[model samples]
Target: MIVRTIRADDYPGLNRLHASVGWPQRSPDGWRWLADNPARREIGAPEGWVLVDAADRPCAMLGNLIQRFVLDGRSLYGATGFSIIVPPQHKGASRPLIQAFLDQPGVFAHYTLNANARSASLYGRLGLRPWPEQTHALKLSWTIDPLACLHGRLLRRAYGRVSAEAAETMGERLMNRRLWRPGPLRLPHGVVDIRDVSDSSPYGRFWGTLSEQGALIADRGAEMMRWRLADPDLPRRPLLLGRVEDGRLTGTALAMTAKTSIIDPPSLEIIDLQGLPGFDAIPLLARTLIRNARGLGAAKVRLQALTPDLLSRLGDLARSARREGGWGHGHAAFSDEAVAASWSPTPLDGDYLMCNRPVPPAAERQWARRRAQASRASKA
Candidate 1:
């Protein structure tokens, strides 16, 4: 087998690699963005590296998400990996591919968010340690549709017992509602659905300050934000609730629907929450998300891996669901432990595909057509 830089023409082989592992096909545009996007090349990093067999057939592929990072007052680059796959017959192909990602020059850090638990020993040996516990250790969640929550659980016969107990003892919605009563927001104009993320807008201005905090963080400026919002595999657009004042963002929250497996219930997730320190609009966005979750008919809303400051501002808004330990491992190549611990990791900080279950664009289009036909029939 020979390892080489991934080329734009490798999309088909990569899809085949994913299919061999029982995973669904990824979006063509999305795959191109990872392995052939201008962002990767502009940073002077390989698009990605691939391992091919003797017949020139690609057997394994590991894609890269390389981006600029600011750490301890120094401007540098960081690399986070995505779409790593190797068939059983190929055996031990993961280490070399991962090493190739880390081996690049001018990189300050190398981390991954979707690595499996079985890779813990291997990752440890590769010098990629677990990320801080501030976000990864605990998960907090809120229930928007208690009936639907209880209903889906009952079908799974798994987490349903807890819901059944809550139903019997506390009554549905009582515990969640009493924790915090969030009212509609209006800081001079209430919260607005962030319709524009142009660099001159408040959304872009907000990330500008965050990136300069002089800590370990992914590029969150307009360019990357725009790329994420245009996710080719996203089922729909994510909701961004913002409170702006005098052309600056005071606070904002972004919510998206994600599922790791087909068996998982539809989840409305709060993935990014930060703004002018001490801004009080988090609960307002939380309220809006819960309201929206109901509108979308989602079962449960989740708060995943937010920074400590962002998490604290919510203040008992959601119950602690479970502990999510160590899906990430990396060490800072330039900065120290203090800088590494400061990174506010959301799914946004890593591959968007980490939490997203890719639904082929064709399938999505077909579903839209069916909905339109149903609407026409109803009018008739």
Candidate 2:
């Protein structure tokens, strides 16, 4: 088998392989993003590799992304998405693709992938130790709750009532089509008022701002967000914008209509969920969403969450697969189920502050001490 970097001409083959293997293959927008991405050349197809049989046939392929993030006051990089397209039975061809990934020096301190136990064993054999990680899924079989459906209707009416013109303009600008309604639901305790992704005030601005920070790793700007959120291919995907009374975006959730393996009916899966510091609304959100999905005549609501908070909160819902973080600009799949099911803590060298290990306890204490001193000095 020939394991090597993928070329520009190799996209079709790679795409085909991913499709055959039942992976969430790239879309046209993703393809465009990859082609024009500055990281394409650096990490080899955005830290991806392709393997070919001696006949030069594309036998197996995998892609990895390295991302930089701050965790526990330290900078770290995480390597993720070690996607393999070759069937598990093709042991010879598959080994090289993963081997090529590990061969890179200092390329990853930790690594992750969305593989089941069988595939995970291969990673363990290759020196990629497993961390406690998870992915979650929700089966949308329950009928939509009448009350929740009414609430969504009321939210939409309230939004429209705010100004038919504003609603119309936003619909055109954001292409929002979720059946939302303004409500006075007796929300549970700590159930903060979740702002609609369409809320035009501080919520929208906050989202744009946070997205900008996330985009800095890449060279793109507003155009990137537009491309990501408004990709024509991702229709019926609700982009939620929410905030608390303190004007902080407490929770940002997005749901997209899609099919699932667990259920036969259509369902809306949460692609992403972002909450403010110390606020974990995923379980509540998941429960609410499940109720809502039943109300929507769907079977389930699935969410992919990888944050530390959700990982701990919904640990029980975790699947057997392991998911590593990846670098590059792509759609953020934030869902409670996905988070619960497939979150791995493999650290790429550049993605997290403590990518290699949970920040050593001593280091964390020292950092905390210094931070406290700095705060005291500022007050003095």
CA lDDT, every prediction?
0.63, 0.43
lDDT of 1 by residue, 267-355 (tens): 66776766656567777677667766655545677765555765677766644443344444322233345556566666566664333
Q: Given candidate 2, what's the lDDT at residue 243?
A: 32
State in Å the error of residue 364, model 1: 7.4
- By lDDT, the best candidate is 1
In model 1, the worst 10-residue window by lDDT is 171-180
Q: State the TM-score for model 1.
A: 0.76
For 324-367, candidate 2 gives per-residue lDDT tens digits of: 22321111222123222322321111121111111112223444
- For TM-score, the strongest prediction is 1
- Which residue pairs in candidate 1 collide? 185-190, 186-190
lDDT, residue 266, model 1 = 58
Looking at candidate 1, what is the lDDT of residue 41? 64
Model 2 scores what on Cα lDDT? Answer: 0.43
